[model samples]
Target: MSLQQVEQIISILNKQSKPYEWVIQEFHKVDELKDFDLDLETFELLGLAFYLNQDNCLSLKTRTTKIKEETFCIVDIESTGGIKHGQILEIGAVKIKNSKELDRFNTLIKVDQIPENITELTGISFDMVENAPNLKQVLRDFKLFLRDSIFVAHNVRFDYGFISKALHECGLGILLNRYICTIEFAQCCIQSPKYKLDVLKELLGIESIHHRALSDALAAAEIFKYCLSKLPYHVQTTEELIKFVKTSRTQRKIAI
Candidate 1:
């Protein structure tokens, strides 16, 4: 399908609360799309983008029959907070399978300077990263480390966006890995007054240091596991879980 057609499909899916099967049926009704051969993966990717656009939650198709069998790479990053202009100071990720942590990746990027305020926040100083590897090298290694595992974070957009942009600048291109947001999942799965990582850390009694990348990533991973355990029995697949969370958020907004 053409890029425009894919975008149109994504737009329609975003504005309406229809599942992939229903959306595909409606798309087939269009004379233009009727002749086009679109595969299940393309449709699912577009549907995945619909939710990602809503709040940076991207779910990819998984061959695993159960959630526990799937692999998740829970990631977190500490950056200069400059968005387009800032640089990433550190990256941390933990790979989990079958609800158990299998491995971890952590690194600091060399930066010429870091603001005092940022240093104060993350306790990462310019001196610390001065001798660390460059962005390109770190990203190269990180990309390989990530593989095809599902990308996850507390607020997925910020971390994922920064990493994606950095990768592009380093000639690595955008990350197509499906992402999940613990913050969004927590809002859907738990009735919490606040869903901030620190708040949830205290509320859920998860032991971890705050602010640092690895610790925060570990905290998010814990929350993710907890949320999965609380998911409805019918929500088994990744796609179903994404739909359930999106619908729950919509219902909550309407109630408010």
Candidate 2:
């Protein structure tokens, strides 16, 4: 219902993952918990809108799905500035299934202002967004394109956090999908000196435009697949793959 509620779902799962009973009780809302029927209806509504699942797991697809079978939405966004006040100028995503790009979504969002420096960096002026769809409509469409896939982005926190906040602002609820940062994921698998999408794209010889959303998303999709090939042999399930990148900080420190 709220960002905090979605966050509560994620926090509980990361700590004590399982079915509804264990998680619902922890919410201090056991009175609302039921083994079936109405409870499932509630969760199904949450799941349909926010990616929460009937199993009470926020990352329903990531829990047991194999890495090779999972569909990853590699995304990139050009925003006006900071997440707190900025608007998304553009958003682009590449849906990757079995290490191949299966679908794509790209759109500019209508806005009235964009800082000069932001314009310089992303080449996205207010004029460019003038005729585009509003953020709410774009978010609703993006949600449909996103489906239940794992979200991937270079600096995932910014994109994921920003989009989640924007979605909430648009009354779309927060994203409950599992996500992975390519920078973190790359650290676990590659020896790149820099992890910025443009930097890694150059290092990896991925040819694409630098700042635009769709081009960058395509580049990130390449990076995601490239890094996937380098993952430890044991990283089979989507859970293990997500876990692998998350534990990268400590694991990479050992090599340093």
Candidate 3:
């Protein structure tokens, strides 16, 4: 699926208000999404989540949920090198609800080879993943663990884009969960010389192994919580937080 299409879908969802009105049953018709397919395939390929409400109308889950009640899955991955040509070597994630971590998903992905440079960076050698599960299995499991929770990462786009690409390559659909990028979100909350995961890790005094997937994911989770605590009173819904990091989307880019 085209990534641009997913972005377009997100724009539509972001603009939706009082989600109940969009429910087909309530309106006796599909409005904004009349031409949009809300099927499983569409949901997976677009990285969005919606469900049939008690009224039997489809409603966007993230839009209605309060930020304090939302669940977030902070994710990080280690790959061979590049998004286009590389393979994911490891997947690590932490599930957060109400600012606390409740569970984690961590696994190594089996690959044919590991480049030396990648090994030097992440310290994950081919042998490290030699006995691990295959790419498709790991991704399938990750998707299950992810559920409809928000997909969060340090540089949201890279991890999100890479995983979406990897899933499609494995014949799985793209990720449709709403996501938050710690890098951009941090910029709105803290003053830092740089917002790289490692840079913020040091500035924020977050302790973790620098390059490993789980460690990095934990570090990003810390950053995610920090940013949340700094959010203005006006921003309370999950959709508001999702739109907060992108300056153009929110009323004003918050800088503390």
Q: For each candidate, what TM-score against the reference?
A: 0.75, 0.82, 0.85
Off by over 4 Å in 2: 1-8, 11-59, 249-256
lDDT of 2 by residue, 1-256 (tens): 3445655666556554456555545443422222324343344332322235666544344556789888899999999888988888999999988998899999999987989999889888878888999999999889888866788999998899899888766666566567889888878766767778778888888999888999998998888888888776778988788778887644663221
What does candidate 1's lDDT look like per residue over 192-220, in tens digits? 78989989898789998888999999999
Model 1 bad stretches (over 4 Å):
1-60, 63-65, 250-256
Question: Weakest 10 consecutive residues, lDDT, candidate 1?
Answer: 44-53
Ranking by TM-score: 3, 2, 1
**Residue 216 accuracy (lDDT) in model 3:** 93
| Root-mean-square deviation of candidate 2 | 4.9
lDDT of model 1 at position 161: 79
User: On residues 60-97, what C-alpha lDDT tens digit does candidate 3 reach at each position?
Assistant: 77778899899899999998878888888999999999
Give the Cα-based TM-score of candidate 1 against the true structure: 0.75
Quick one: ranking by lDDT, best first? 3, 2, 1
> How far does residue 247 in candidate 2 sit from its true spot (Å)?
1.1
RMSD of each: 8.5, 4.9, 4.9
- List of clashing residue pairs for candidate 2: none
Better of 1 and 3 by TM-score: 3
Error of 3 at 183 (Å): 0.4
